[model samples]
Structures are given as C-alpha cells and as structure tokens.
Target: MTAPSQVDYHDVLQVWREADTIPEIEHAWLFDHLMPIFGDPSGPAYEGWTLLSALAAQTRRLRLGLLVTSNRFRPPAMLAKIAATVDIVSGGRLDFGIGVGSRPSHPLARHEYEAHGLPFHDTAHAVGSLAEACTVIRRLWTEAEPFDFHGTYVQLTGAFGNPKPVQGPHPPILIGGRSAATLRVAAEHADLWNIPGGDIDDVVRRSALLDRYCTEIGRDPASITRSIHLQVSYDQPSITRDAIGEAIDAGFRHIVLGLPAPYPADVTRWVTDELIITSAYYDSPI
Candidate 1:
C-alpha cells in the first residue's frame, strides 16, 4: 500500500508497475485522502480513485484498489458507478475497499472534511451512513432494474447502474476499520475486513467481535477473509517480518505492506526479497 501523498505520480507508478511483475505481491493499494495526512500539511495529495483508475489501466495481473475509500466523500450511487468503471478499466481486478471516513480523534483526518467543504458528521451518523452506502452500492451493482431506496442516511430515486462491473455480481467488498459499529457493517456487507496492524491482541479481540456479529446476523464468520495492513520499516526488515508472522498467526491471510515514501530504487524487489520472502512465516501457506 502506498499513500499517494508526499510522492510523485511517476514514483507511485514505478512501485506499482514493479509490484505487478512480482507474483509474490498479489495486490497493490492507494489511500483515499484529499489532503496530505502526513508530512507537509500543504503537500500534494492526489485523488485516490482517479489515480487508481490510471494505475488500473496501466497494470495487469495485479489486483488493485484504494486501501479503503471514504464513504463520506461521494454519494453511494455515484461511487458505485465510479467503481464499476474502474472494474471495467482493470478488466475486473478491482477490490472495492471502503470505510466510514476518518475518525474525529485524528486531527489531520478531521481537517480534510472541512477543507473540501464536506460535512463532518458524528461517529454514529458516519457508521449508519456507511451501512446504508454498502447496501445501496451492492444493489446498484447487482440489480437489473432501476430502484428507489429510502434509508436514514441514503435516499435514491430511480437509481440504477449500467455497464455493470466486469466482475460477476460485483467486485469483492473489503471494509477497513476497527470500530465495533464498523465491524457490524462489515459482518453484513464486507467480503474482507481489514484493520491496521498493531496490538495483535486487540486485533484478535476485534476479529472475535466480528465473528460474534456475523453469528448474530446468521452469516458465516469464515465467509469474510481477514486482512491487515502492516507498515513496512525500511531500516529494519526483521520488524516487518515479525509483524507479518504475528498477523498471519492471528488468521490474517491477506497482508498489505504499507510502503513509505520516498520509495527507494527497486523498492518492490526489496519488498519481495527482504520483507516477503524472508519473513519468518514465509514458508507457511498463506
């Protein structure tokens, strides 16, 4: 995963293009943020979905997507259309990741909403809207006929999606968040659940809570794949390797290594060699 902030487009393209050729790196990702969340507050931060579409058009054989899109940024129906377009562009390699925007606790994240003239709702509103967004997006992808939707957070009239995503049914929905409310939404809508890697015990507890939510909803908990995003430490590959091992042991089969910028020369190769291949759990079936 590469945060598209504080980096050039060519640099991002270079890393992704390299990763595409490496079979070990199955997927690549970009984060959704209108402004720089780290480094210079005024630094350039490319729009994620736009850049994702560009990357999708350039790469083949590697599944790709925004690490998770912010549901608050765009209307659900419009986002469904955008995602479908990207799926078509990528020949169906898009993994649709989304979340309930940023948390209010993070000052950097909170500022973007106001910066872009987007409302910053309370946590309850954000979570509820996310649930509605998922429902509306799925219907837009799968429903053949135009439909009307009325929900607390979403209202649509004659909403329909044409040129359905190339993927049958729809692209895999990957929801990223650690909140219990978000987990409940994931229990119902996500094909995969992702949380930032740290505090392995807490992650395990969250995973258990998701399982309980799924059980309560009569959905198989195992149906949702567990995913984790572990930040790559350029200076110490061993640290990342240990984290990967722990995440895998914790039942996270999908591991997304977050690459920090400025990306080194042959960074993807370095990732495959030093981080992935040398991981203690590298020999274990993933």
Candidate 2:
C-alpha cells in the first residue's frame, strides 16, 4: 500500500464529515463487469477504467483502483497505459488490482461470458494469460526502450508505454484470489494480495503457501502486503471490529469492508467513533 501523509485525527474526521465533498477515504475500488450478473442482471455497469479516470480526477487523497479488474476486460498494454495515466492524474494513488478471469462455474457468470462473447476458458488458460499479462505490463512500465513480447497468451512488438506512472516503477499491483494459480501470480508479481474474509488459521495456511511460492520464485514474501474483504452493513460493529482484529493478527494490513448498497450514515459515524477513533489510524472516508 502507498503510505499517505500523517494528518490530525480531527482532520480525518473532517474529511469523513464532508461525505459529499471528496470524502477522504484511504482507498476506493471498482469492479469489472459488462452487466450486473450478481444483482439486477440487466442493470448498468460502469466500465472500470473510464469511471476510475473520472474518480482519480475528482478525489485528492483517496487511492483509486479496481477491486479486481478481469484480464479478459482489456489488452495488457492498454490496461497498463490506462493505469499509468490514472496514477499520474491522481498524483500516484492507484492500487491497480488485476485477476485472471477464472470465475467459478455459475449460471450468471456463464451468461455474462456468452453475452459479451468473452471466452470462458478453463482455469489453466486463465492463469497462463494472467502471468503473461503481468509480465507484459511490468515490462512496459520499466523498460526505457521499446521491446517485443511473444508469450503463449500475449504477444506485442515494438511496444512502449509512455507517461509512466508517478509511482516509481509502477503503481501498486494488488492481486486477489485464493486459488493456487492466483496465489502463484501474487507471489511472483503482486505488491498486495487480497483474499476473502476467513479465520486466523485460514490466513496462516494461505500465507504459508504464498510464502513457499515466493521462495521458489526468489521473491521475498514479506514484500507483499496481505489484505482481505469483509462484508459490512450499518449495524455490524462487533462483526467489523472482530474481523479487523482477526485480519491484523493474521498479517493483513489492508481490510476492505464490502459495504452493501444503500450506504448508511450511522455506520460511518460508528466506524469513526469506535474503529477509527480507537485505532487512531488514517482511513479514507468513502
């Protein structure tokens, strides 16, 4: 995670209070989808990259990114350039998340794939594409001179990604998933690893596996930040506190609370008074 400047507690509260005015949030995330397959099925879905550019321009301190942008959604070079542009626009506050589009077999997911004419490849293909895409993205960001990439899944020639991200090297690459293939990708390339909420031992097991992968690949496991997403509603303070503590103990620094729709003001106040005030940590007020 990118470290933000220290601010007084009241200042953070002020940002929270101004909920409508560039609410000070630590990070904001978007989802990649052609339609609301999980919800309305026919409702509108914002194209993550376009909306993210808008968000980057609108906010000042909050980190803007996708929760997990599907690799199926864009070409590797194109997504890299889009991420770099947003990082520059937002003053280097992009947590660029990405994932292989290896979704579990579900009717909704199948429908989405059919609707968009996107291939619903097996997990192995997804994993391969993800790894190759990561390589291409990183190369575009770091290479000073144009280069060619010919991989099993992705190929590019005479490619150069200009206007590199404001973040040195590139913006934070946050990878999300618990599958072995996904974890391997995280160990190889991610600056942050995000998983769903689980018990302490769950984290321990996954971290150990990720560590093994990191070691095999000659990467330092400690270099990656651990994160998890926990669903939250207005009246679940106890759930929130307990989840946060569990995640912290399990070595996760970033806990993304999955806020169910129809956001509540009281929940925000409760978070400010209990979670934020008690911990005395700076967080985005989104």
Highest-scoring model, TM-score: 1
Question: Where does model 1 exceed 4 Å of error?
Answer: 283-286
* Native-referenced Cα lDDT, model 2: 0.73
How many residue-pair clashes does candidate 1 contain? 0
- Tens-place lDDT digits, model 1, residues 28-87: 999999999899998999999999999999999899988899999999999999999999
Q: In candidate 2, list every pair of residues with a backbone clash.
A: 24-284, 24-285, 25-284, 25-285, 26-284
Best by lDDT: 1
Regions of model 2 farther than 4 Å from truth: 1-25, 266-270, 279-286
Clashing residue pairs in all predictions, respectively, total 0, 5
**Residue 105 alpha-carbon offset, candidate 2, angstroms:** 1.6
| CA lDDT scores, all candidates in order | 0.94, 0.73
